[model samples]
Target: MPMPAQEIEELIRAGIPDAQVEITDLAGDGDHYSARVVAESFRGLPRVRQHQLVYEALGGRMGGALHALQLTTACPTEE
Candidate 1:
């Protein structure tokens, strides 16, 4: 079974309370998705680490309930 976009968003929010998450279904199949996540905690992290935070938020859902995710992560800009 495929995962719901809302579920993915909720999961991320639960893991990273301050994160801003946007999820897009690329294939309309619920099996593929793209997510953009921004958080203050990511400020000093490397890109690889930023991505890892998102993957961790998914709680090992990759390659299982969630098939694939194209993720982009960043820290909020200072004003």
Candidate 2:
């Protein structure tokens, strides 16, 4: 079975707590998704590390229940 977009967002939020997450089904299919995650905690992190955090939040589901994820991560803009 494929993962739901809401579940993905929820999982990210659960892991990042203060993150703002946006999930989109790029192919209109549950297996392919794109996620944008923004969090204050990512401020000083490298892009690779930021992506790792999001991957970790998925809890090893990357190749199983979830097929593909195009992820974008960033710190919240200073405003």
- Every model's TM-score: 0.96, 0.97
The whole-model C-alpha lDDT of candidate 2 against the native structure comes to 0.94
Clashes of each: 0, 0
User: Which 10-residue window in model 2 sums to the lowest lDDT?
Assistant: 70-79
Error of 2 at 61 (Å): 0.3
lDDT tens per residue, model 1, 1-79: 9999999999999989999999999999999999999999999899999888888988999999999999999888889
lDDT of 2 by residue, 1-79 (tens): 9899999999999999999999999999799999999999999999999999999998999989999999999998887
The alpha-carbon root-mean-square deviation between model 2 and the true structure, to one decimal in Å, is 0.6
Candidate 1 TM-score, C-alpha based: 0.96
Error of 2 at 51 (Å): 0.6
Among all candidates shown, the one with the greatest TM-score: 2
